[model samples]
Target: MEALNEELERAGAWVFGAGLEPASSATVIRASGSVSMTDGPYAETKEQMGGFWIIDVPDLDTALDWAGKAGAACEQPVELRPMQRA
Candidate 1:
């Protein structure tokens, strides 16, 4: 995360958001014959989403570029997905 943030810094971009989430803070809602809200994880899991980042870029290549940098920067996993034009 530190390294990735550094790359963004050199590029004049910054890590928008990054943090950890607890499994307890999450709730799962489902619509069935009756709606239900469950405690704890909607499903059993080990490690949940720890953190995330949102970076503004011009296009796909730019997004991928950032993702690659981030992946290399952190020992943990990193993912990148293009958002629909909004």
Candidate 2:
């Protein structure tokens, strides 16, 4: 983990962001015609997002490459999503 963080820092790709709380600590909020709040995670599933890393890479392939590295380093799946552009 330390090595990965150092590598990302050296590559100028790490975008520091807040780490999410555990699923048990999450509060799900929803709104349409009216606002409603729910305790716990948005869904009752074993799979939950613990945290995220925002890495600025050249393209999707590059992002995937980084994701692969992350997966190997952490022994966990790394999901890649493109940023929405205006």
Candidate 3:
């Protein structure tokens, strides 16, 4: 993880990432004229999001390159998504 962050810094695209609480510790809230609270994961799945990183880069290609590096370093899948235009 440290190495991945370092690589992002070297590429001048580092942003920030926060570690998430365990899914069991998460709380879900819902509302539709009424409110409800669920004490657990938002849904059941074979996988769960552990954390995320946001990077600033010039374009999609650069972002994908960085994401590939991240995936290689962590031995886990990495997803890339472009932020909506302002």
Query: Which candidate leads the pack in TM-score?
Result: 2
Off by over 4 Å in 2: 44-46
Residue 41 error for model 2, in Å?
Answer: 0.7
Which of the two, 1 or 2, has more TM-score?
2
The C-alpha TM-scores of every prediction are 0.65, 0.85, 0.83
- For 16-59, candidate 3 gives per-residue lDDT tens digits of 87668778888888898999998888686667677789999998
Tens digits of per-residue lDDT, candidate 2, 8-64, equal 989998887335777899888889899999898867577887667888888988888
Query: What lDDT would each prediction earn against the true structure?
Result: 0.74, 0.80, 0.83
Clashes of each: 0, 0, 0
Per-candidate Cα RMSD to the true structure, in Å, reads 3.1, 1.7, 1.6
> In angstroms, how far off is 42's CA in candidate 3?
2.0
lDDT of 3: 0.83
Error of 3 at 26 (Å): 1.3
lDDT of 1 at 30: 86
Clashing pairs in 3: none
In candidate 1 the C-alpha lDDT for residue 64 amounts to 82
Q: Model 1, range 1-86, lDDT digits (tens) per residue?
A: 77677777777666477786777888888899999998777576665776777787777898888877776666567777765778
RMSD after Cα superposition, model 2: 1.7
Ranking by lDDT: 3, 2, 1
